[model samples]
Target: MGGTVTLRRALLATTAATVLAFLPNTAQAAVSYPDPQPITGQQIIHDPTVVRLKSGGYVAYSTGGVIGARLSKDLKHWDDAGNAFAEPPSWWYEYNDTGDPWAPDISYRDGTYWLYYAVSSWGTNHSAIGVATSPSGRPGTWTDHGKVFTSEKTDTWNAIDPAIIKTDGRLWMTFGSYWTGIRMVQLDRTTGKAVQGATVHHLATRPDAPYAVEGPYIVKHGRYYYLFASYDQCCAGVNSTYKIRVGRSTSVTGPYVDSTGKPLLEGGGDLLLEGHGRYIGTGGESVFRAKGHDWLAYHYYDADDEGTPKLGLNQLHWKENGWPIAL
Candidate 1:
């Protein structure tokens, strides 16, 4: 009787362990991500922010070459349209010696196209976010508007990867990098620069040191404001660990939390999309609306094509629970 009881107990323990092995964890669970939509032509880009133009078609602005530009008629086959500026703005040299700009955000507002971009040396917190205006959302039409915001080495937040949104009739820009994660500041409606004496608001950060979250792009869907950000190391080609994560809050300035009710500041973000198969290091994401649907635009390191960072686009779907799923 004792031997039979021991055997039964051991069998139950083994079955329990097997079931536990298949359970999901926050960071390492096996979640299959869909591949990016097929794209062709000049696909190489980094930190892409796409916007549908008022005139026609689509344009993408990204890091490198005085805010590199790519134009597409159908959002499928992209063509390199050269740098947005003929030369780097004179003031951009104050932060970076080369005047090399990075991670531009472009949007059309009130009959004018606004361009916000960053200038900073690699691995430094001394940075500046600059704004420009374009009569037409074309490569060479942008007129530099000088620095909209800046951050020094003494600051906890690194000012880069600028993303803009308007809510409650006020303009706000969310920007940050590795130092303290994502942050936000109110902008002047007319000038499009950070308001004088504006209170800088903390948005998201990892609990651990060297907090890796950055590239914050917020979109209001239904009743919740969804904050999309890239997490982990980037620009290392195939070895990069970059992936996209998200959290949502009712307020524009959030105590944003993941689907599990964990705060983003506490390293709580639901994994929206990540590297899988040949598309390695998928990150640097932004959202845009076109054809009556929301679309996600980002860049991914293509392992099959020498790990070149290229454009990745996917349709975003909202679940019944109001969470976003990238299809």
Candidate 2:
């Protein structure tokens, strides 16, 4: 009887071990993504905005003279779709076109693809925002809407990086950089232009902070309008201190507060992401939802090289309290 009991006990122990080996660990399943690879159609693809095409593919547009579409069936391993905007629209160059086309925020609205762009001559106040419409986001077809807005030296700020958000049955644009932080103005729904007599409000500012804040991207989620912008100096190679910061408010107009309950217009921004390892100054951010998950696409100066900026993407996870964290 004792020998039989010993054998049974050993068999039970063996069975437990086998079951444990086959069981999946809950911790390892939480974080899983394919190893990241550099996006195609290079030459500083900064401030990337991605969207899903009607046929179920993805296209991304960014800064520089670098406006090209990428064909991504699964949001990974992209193929170049060639140049989306070959030249600055005549209306834009009629005034000034010195800065090499900065951020391009493309969105589908009113049965058309709207492409909002920025132009400037380096640090001068000649900066302006312009718009172009295309039947599709593909290359070789774009109609210029002329200059939408411009800045003067007296304004004490440069106008660039225009992000359009339609809220409450009306359209609004948020844009600015360096000299005066980020600002927003209401736009006419019919013409898609800034509404006259609409007051532009100071959204966020951090001049005294290490770097200036730019790249204003607004997304409405769960009854809150989240304002995302890049803080600090970007594109300084290894010396770049750029990072993404965010604030949110229930009302679209005023009083955006950070995680600390401090107003962003008063220089309070909750830090979202910064450089890590060979990546430096991960700024120029645009957020998108894909495959039932939110993702952030931005650019960073590569650590492997000295001064080249490359595209970087990471999934954005939100907490129960409604703040976004990069996963």
Q: Which one wins on TM-score?
A: 1
Instruction: Compose the digit string of candidate 1's lDDT tens values, residues 99-162.
Output: 9998999988899999999999999999999999998889999998899999998999988999
**Over 4 Å off in model 2, which ranges?**
1-44, 94-99, 207-211
**Structural similarity to truth (TM-score) of each candidate:** 0.91, 0.84
Give the Cα error of residue 235 in candidate 1, in Å: 0.5
By summed lDDT, the worst window of 10 consecutive residues in model 2 runs over: 26-35
Error of 2 at 170 (Å): 0.9
**Global lDDT of each model?**
0.89, 0.74
What is residue 32's positional error in candidate 1, in angstroms? 1.2
Residue range 160-254, candidate 2, lDDT tens digits: 88998987888988998887688998877767677777787888887474228899999888989999999888768889998888899998876
What are the clashing pairs of model 1?
none
Deviation of model 2 at 239, angstroms: 1.8
